[model samples]
Target: MTLGTSTSPLHYYDVSSVDGFNLQVSMVPVGGGVGCGVTGCETDLNICSPSTFE
Candidate 1:
């Protein structure tokens, strides 16, 4: 059997986003000689303050 053809760009995977119960990792260039690994972005933020009461 033969597979179908892909009309999208070679780097199409890096230019797309996913949504749902599944998890995926994506990389995108930021600037000169630099790139970033972005995933589970919700956990990468400071949504709460440090412990104050013990």
Candidate 2:
């Protein structure tokens, strides 16, 4: 995602799990201003640790 314009209102975003991931993900940018920031993968990944999915 990419957005900028409206006199330079900018926000570029990316969140991926390389085609696989189970649950827990986030991005919050409400009332954006002054470096609108928040992005995440609050890990649960189906109880990860099976060799970290190789």
Over 3-42, each residue of candidate 2 has an lDDT whose tens digit, in order, gives 8789876668888877757666789988888877888888
lDDT of 1 by residue, 1-54 (tens): 122358632331222223321233444444423333343333322234244311
Whole-model lDDT for model 1 versus the true structure?
A: 0.33
Candidate 2, lDDT over the whole model: 0.78
Q: Which pairs of residues collide in candidate 1?
A: none
Clash count list over all predictions = 0, 0
TM-score of every model versus the real structure: 0.18, 0.34
Model 2: which ten-residue window has the lowest total lDDT? 45-54
Whose TM-score is greatest here? 2
